[model samples]
Every structure is written in structure tokens, then in C-alpha cells.
Target: MLKTALGRYINNFKGFTHEVWILALITFINRAGTMVLPFLSKYLKEDLQFTYGEVGWIMVSFGLGSMLGSWLGGKLSDKIGFYKIMIFSLFTSGILFILLQFVTTFWGLCFAMFIIMAISDMFRPAMFVSLSVYAKPENRVRALSLVRLAVNLGFTAGPALGGLIIIGMGYQGLFWVDGITCMIAISIFAFYIKEKKKTSINKDNIVLSDLPKSIYKDKPFWLLLFISFVTFMVFLQIFSTLPLYHNEKFGLSEFQTGMLLSINGLLVFLLEMPIVSTLERKGVNKIKNIAYGCFFIAAGYFILLFDSWVGILVISIVLLTFGEIFSFPFVNAVALSRAPKGQEGQYMGFYTMSFSLAHIVSSKTGLEIIAHYNYQINWLIMGTLGLLALLCCFWLNELVHTKKKS
Candidate 1:
């Protein structure tokens, strides 16, 4: 019975083209090498002796750059091509990461963070569109999930590897690894992955005119964006504030903290694709799935309110992992599939920007709250935000159904 189930699970991954697999592999290498971000907050606070507020501001710089990059990547992918942007973003950012270790001052670091992130995050929206170019209509959702799996798989390795690197070479080692990985990841793509011409393909099967062409005017899409923002905000906190919480409240070492964080990635790596495939096959409502995901995420934060036992930490992360697995792939599918064929880059670019915006809010607000209030208070606030996102999803669902009937 177990073997049958395992075989069934593996079956969901089979249909993707070689290009999709290559894209997934590229995403994995790039993301796996992303060791610096998971520990950036701790590095800033502990190694550089920066205050929480300072860290918040630097992250703001990082996020603003990410926002700018997302917009540019989308725009450029439309105007030039995703291929050029991907090459430039990774290669430039790789050089920047190595050089960033030199700047220890507050303002200098802030400027550096913003510039590097702007270049790096350009890779995101471009990559999202690349999947559209590479994947077939039938295989698109799983293709997106494959990339997410790569991300989580990379993340699964990143925190654990990062922890060891920190121990051996201190935080400086993370910078070098991060930088080298970016270049290596891009080099593989540059050498082997030729740029494919964008074709007039419609993955959603619905008429393009049925959906709003302008992202700004699409009310349902706005709600989806808000839902995505809340999800990213909550998830980003684990990397930003939660590490500090583990150190101060739980008295866990960097290695122990990495292990705890790696659990989230490991669970996602193992579960997300199968879960995503199952839901798609069952013809589940994407909005409803996202709403439930919101509840799980909120509960993850709410559980943090009971931090007496170390076991609660493990349980909370489990819930958060479920929340992530449910919402993210569907969100990408809905956005990417609905996009007008010629303007996919704009739609996905803006979609990814929501995440970057959430990163800004997540990092700065989380740090500020941690600095001013206690961890419980911060957790309480985050949980409330998750609930708000849940309510919004419900509203969006009703509106979408109402429109369909009209």
C-alpha cells in the first residue's frame, strides 16, 4: 500500500518537458545557494552590532530594490527578453554579494543592500515568465510547482548549510558561497539554456477577454495580491524576526535554529507537489484552498502565543509549512494562466512585486515590533494580519462567483 502511494506521488512529476526540468534545476541551484538571506538579520544585529531598527531599514533598502527589480524585470522581459535579464541579474548580483562584505557602516550597507537586491530580484519575475515559455499548457501548474519544489529543496539545504558556514567561516563565508552560487547557477543557464521565443499560448483555456487585461483594475486579482502579500509577509518573518526569537527566547544556537527552519523547507519539498497535483486533479476551488491556507498560517502564528514548551516551535512551523504549500503554487497558476499571452511579463512582474512589497513590510515592521514590544505581541499582530487576509479571500471568492453568474 505504501509503495503504491509512493508510486502515485511520483507519477505527478512525470509529464514536464526537458525545458521545464532545466528551469527547475536552474531555480534550484540559484535558490539553494541563497544562504545569505536566511541569516542576514542575525548577521546585521550580531556581527555588525546594528540595532533592530537599523536592520529594518537595511531590509527596507533590500525590499525597495527588490520592488524596483521586479517591475524592471517584467518590463524588460516584455521589451527585450527574459534571457538577457536573467543573465544580467544573477551575474551582477553575484559580484555585488562578494563586494557587500566590505561595507560595515549603516548607510553604506543600506545602499549596498538596495542595489544588490534590485539586481537579484529581477531574476524572479523573469523566471516566472520563463516557465510559461518553457512549459506546455497542460503541464504549467506542475511546472510552477516544480520550481517551488526546487525553491523549498534549495531552502531545505540552504539554512542547514548556512548554519555550518557561519560556524566555520563566520557570516563572511555565507557571502562567498551566495555569490559563487549565483554566478554558477546563471552560468549553467547561459551556456546551455537558449532563449525560446514567446508564443501565443493560453494556459487557462478561458477566453482572454473574460479576464481584465489591466492588473490595476482587476478587483479579484487585487484580492489575490493582498492574499499573496499576507502569505509572503508571514513567511518572511521566519527568516527575519523568528531567528532572533529562537536565539533570545528559546536560547537555541545558530545550528539548532537552522535545523528548526530547515524543517519548514523539508516538509514543503516532500509534500507540495503531491498536494498541488491532488487538488488540481480533484477540481478544487483555488480561492477556497488559499483561504484555508490563510487559516493555517494564522494558526501558525497564533500557536506561537504558547511558547512555554520547545515543542510548540516545531508544531507552529508545521502549520506554517502547510499554509505555504497550499497558497503559493495556486496563486502563481491563477496569475500566470490568466495573463494575456503578449503581456505575461507585466502581469507576472506585478504579481511578484506584491511579494517584494510584502518583504519590505515584513522585515521592517517585524523588526520594529520586536524592538518596541515583546515577541508575543509581534506574533499576535502577525496572526491578526493573517486572519484579515483570510476574510479578504472569502470576499474575493464571493465576488468572483458573482461575476461568473453575471
Candidate 2:
């Protein structure tokens, strides 16, 4: 039984095209070297000695850049093709990441972070659009899961490597490593994936299957966006606040925190593909699965309410990792499925923008709430947001089914 289960797990990874695998490889390299974001909040607060408010503003700038980038990447992918956008986004953002180490002042750092994130995030929507082109329609979700697996694997490596780099060479080492990896990741992509003309259209020179052309008319999409925003609002805390919480509450070192965060990545890497495969095979509603995801995340946050026990942290992360595994891949698949023939880029852009917006709200609100009240209050608020997302997911499911009936 165990061997059969293992074989099934491995089979889920099969059938992807070469291009999809390359995309996954590129994602792994980039995410593995992405040492900056996980440590950004800690860096601003401790290394720079910035107050919570200042750190919040810098994070706001980061999200604003991500929002703009997400919007532009999608819109342009429709026009210019995802190929050009991916190349330009990665190469330019790499240069910016390296330069960011020099900007120490509060305002300067905010502006720099904004610019860096904007360029870096453009790769997201464009890459999603690329997968639509590269992966077979039936295999798209697995393709997405494949790429996410790369991301999780990278997450596992990045934090551990980042911890070593920080302890050995200081924060400056992170910027250089991140910048170099971005360039390296993209260079392989640019070399291997030559631009194919008239790629977005099929052999018939038109898109055959798609939803309505205008994304704005879709109420279900909008509801999903809101659900995603709420889900990620709680989710983004891991990058921004949770690290601080680990150090402050438990007095863990950077290495310790990295190891702790790595467990979430490790869990996702091990479980997401199999779980997604099982759910897909069962023909469960994506929206319902997302609601389940919302529940898990809310439970994770609420677990944090038991502050007295350090073991609660591990339990909380297990739940949150499950939440991430459930939420993100399906979210990507559903957003891709919604795009009309030429609008893949735009749809993905808006989808990613929701998370960017969430990042803006999550970091700022979380920090401010902690500043004004306490961590307990913040946890309560995040748990509430997760439940709110769960409720919205049900409403979205209804809208989708009703629209189909109509």
C-alpha cells in the first residue's frame, strides 16, 4: 500500500511539457535565492533600528510596487507576450536588488523597495500566462503545482542559506546573493525558451475556448479576489510579522527561525501535489477547497492564541502549511480558467494584484495593531479575516454555480 501510494504521488508529477519544467526550474532558482523578503521586516526593525511605523510604511511601498507590477505584467503579457516581460522583469529586478543594499535612509529604502518589488513581481503574472501557453489544458493545475513545488523547495533552501549568510556576512550578503540568482535564473530561461511568434493564439489563429472577454463582468472572479485578499492578509504575516514573533516571543536565533519557517515549506513540498491530485480526482469544488483552506489558516492563527507553549508554534505552522497548500495552487488554476482568449495576462495580473493588495494591508495593519494593542489582538484580527475569507468562498461558489445555471 505504501509503495502504491508513493507511485501515485510520483505519477502526479508526470506528463508536463518541457517548457513547464523549465519554468519550474526557473522559479526554484529565483525563489531559492530570494533571501530578502523573509528577512525584510526583521532587517528594518533590528538592523536599521526603524520603528514599527517606519517598517510598515516601507512594506506598504513594497506592496504598492507589487500591485503596479502585477497590473502591468498582466496587461502587457496580453499585448507584448509573456516572453519579453519575463526576461525584462527578472534581469532588471536583479540589478535593483543589488543596488538596494546601499539605500539606508527611511525614505530612500521605501522608494527602493517599491521599485525593486515592482520589477520583481512583474515576473509573476507573466509567468502564469506563460504556463497557460506551455502546459496542456488538462495538465495546467499540475503544472501550477509543479511550479509551486519549486517555490516551496526554494523556500526550504533560501531561509536556511539566508540564515547562514546573515550570520557569516551580515545582511549585505543577502542582497548580492538574491540579485545574482535572479539574473542566473532568468538567463537560463531566456536562453532555453526562444520567443515563439503568434504564440497566444492557437493554430487556427484564434482562441477557441474562454469565458466572457471582459474580466470586470465576472462577479465570481471578484468574489474570489476578495477571498484571496482576505486569505493572504493572514498568510502574508509569515513573511512580515511571524519572524519577529519567533524571535521576540521564543528568543529563537535567525537560524532557528529559518528552520522553523522551512518546516512550512518542507511540508508543502511533501504534501501539496498529492493533496491537489486527490482533490482534483474527487472532483471537489475548487471554491469549497478554498473555503477549507481558509478554515485551516484561521485555525492556525487562533492556535497562536496559546502563547504560553512554544510547541504551539509548530502546531500552528502545520495548519498554516496545509492552508497554503490548499489555497495557492487552486487559486492559480481558477484564475487561469477564468481568462478569456487574449486576456490570460490581464486575468492573472488582477489575481496576483489581490495578493499584492493583501500584502499592503496585512503588513501595515498587523504592525500597527501590534504597536497600538498587542500580538494577541493581532492574532484575533487575523483569525477573523480568515473566517471572513471562508465565508466569501462559499458566496463565490454559489455565484459560479448560479451563473452556470443561468
True-vs-predicted CA distance for residue 96, candidate 1, Å: 0.9
Model 2, 1-406: lDDT tens per residue? 9999889888989899888999999999999999888999999999999999999999999999999999999989888888999999999999999999999999999899888888889999999988888888888888999999999999999998999999999999999999999999999999888875434445375444335657897777888888888898899898888999999999988888899889998998889999998898899888888888999999999999999999998999899999998998998898888876788888999999998999999999999999999889999999999999998887888888887777
Alpha-carbon local distance difference test for all models: 0.89, 0.90
- The deviation in Å at residue 305 for candidate 2 is 0.4
Relative to the unseen true structure, what is the C-alpha lDDT of residue 222 in candidate 2, on a scale of 0 to 100? 84
Sliding window of 10 residues with minimal summed lDDT for model 1: 200-209
As for model 2, its CA RMSD to the true structure in angstroms is 1.9
TM-score for candidate 1: 0.97
- The residue-by-residue lDDT of candidate 1 on 1-406, one tens digit each, is 9999999988989989888888788788888889888899999999999988999999999999999999999999988999999999999999999999999999999899989988998999899989988898788888999999999899889999999999999998888888999999889888778989798655678576686868778888877888898888987898999999999998998889889989998999889999999998999998888888889999999999999898999999999999888888888988786677778889888899999999899999998987888899999999999899889888988998998898
Evaluate residue 29 in candidate 2 and report its C-alpha lDDT on the 0 to 100 scale. Answer: 97
